[model samples]
Target: MSNEQVISSVKDSYLVEKRRNQMIKGAIVLFKEKGFHRTTTREIAKESGFSIGTLYEYIRTKEDVLFLVCDAIYDQVRNRLESATDWDNPSVAKLEEIVASYFRLMDDMQEEIIIMYQEVKSLKQESREYVIKKERDMVAMLERMFTACLPETIDEQDVSLLANNIFVQGQMWGFRRWMLQKQFTLEEYIERQIHFLKQSLSTDHMQNEKTDQTP
Candidate 1:
């Protein structure tokens, strides 16, 4: 089930989606300005252009809003990444495109990403676990892509690690932008990363080729 479906008190699916979209848009603006702890449910209601009573109809507490925001951010990132690559015909080039697309998406949502990292700690235990599971699912998506594109010798464990590294590398741009932005443009950063990734994967590919010939 979607985050909206899980938390929203609104019984109608269409209404749940509609109201949550408004709430998310408003909550993001407030969360960016005041951080999660300082942002109040009434404020979120006001920001969302809904009455406090109407807002309550959709969510029970401020924590629900935070959960919704975090879930939406992750979903947006995952959806864009999916569109950026063709799983039916995965290739190294497609992998490169996915990385570049993810970095750009992170850059666009840096403030929200920062908010997610900082305020997710305040969520209830179950909500936090749900968010973590979503992240793992994303890493698994990357792992599948790597498995299709990489040579057989790379091994599942290596692909898994590489997939995680690529995901983290994209997030690092958002989390460490103050330092990275000063040093390199987005294109430069992507180019350097692609070079490093290819170097690592190609080394494994070549070693495997040599071993196969030697026997």
Candidate 2:
């Protein structure tokens, strides 16, 4: 389904965008503070500065708001990753840069990220599926970038796993901050992850080279 269907009752494109943004902004604050289960539609409306009736005009249910927040978070992340890197013929160094940028964005949106992981189960099946698909798209994007970086030397499976791991590592900072923050600053975390990732991928490349040389 199209993203416009995320909020269906509204027909005006501009108004739908405007109201959804307002609702998302408000719902995020509530969800972050009270958690999804405890938060009420009334509170979301109040936080968003809209009446209960107005909230319904844009979203059919509170779950819609949750989905919207998750959607926005991904949109922001993908935008940052795409804009910062040279997508065409990206090098391993460029992939590392993307990973570092992703971690920083996660740090900046830590609270929202926390809510996203903790609350995603609350979304209805269809809504959950949509979010999951968007997530897959993101992982696939990274996989493509890494595959391009290494070309014939890197195993596609290795790139796929690394891409998935990179995505999780970024989210881990948000959900595991209480522990991670005690051990490393954001810059340190970013640096170490990139280093570890580079080392791992390089090892795979070297092994691939050895196998080819042996044959």
Candidate 3:
């Protein structure tokens, strides 16, 4: 590559990785405090240690920062889930691993997850579309993870809904942490959620078998 080409590539890659993270780091603080709708680019710039002008070099608006935060949270969750889970494992096993990984992340990055939950609705039109696609992608990943655990009777829509439900419950866990922590440690809480989940969706058919046999 020419020297100018190499310089541009380095600049682009550095900006791609750095400024976005700077935005996410700044956003975590602002969104937690002022909230998504109330926060401003200048404030985000202050928190992120960049001027509003520099911030705009990477992103055009506060809404962009909002999406960056959402994307960052998902990226972290995806990494945790992928590393801690064995996708080729049986459906039930994969589900358990996914929950474990998810709970680990929620406990580890509680603040960031909390920020995403609180701020996602503030994303603007194109920005909202970007995040919605990422959200769907996350759901799809879990749906595939749900595949092995599902019985023949369950449809994909059911599995997808169940995956979305689990995601929702996990998100709520951060919000209801006072109540959850009151009852159990994070590990114990995860175990409880998994147990309850399996009981609700997983064992119904088996119980039906016993009921059918008894007659």
Could you arrange the candidates by lDDT from highest to lowest?
A: 1, 2, 3
Tens digit of per-residue lDDT, candidate 1, span 3-65: 443565668888888988899989999998998988899999899998999999988889888
Candidate 2's C-alpha runs over 4 A off are 1-3
In model 1, state the lDDT of residue 179.
99
Winner by lDDT: 1
Candidate lDDT values, in order: 0.87, 0.83, 0.73
**Per-residue lDDT of 31 in model 3:** 83
lDDT of 2 by residue, 41-114 (tens): 99998988889998888888888889989898888887887886786657777777778888899899988888
Write down the RMSD of all candidates, one decimal each.
1.7, 1.8, 5.2
All candidates: TM-score: 0.93, 0.93, 0.80
| Lowest lDDT block of 10, candidate 2 | 1-10
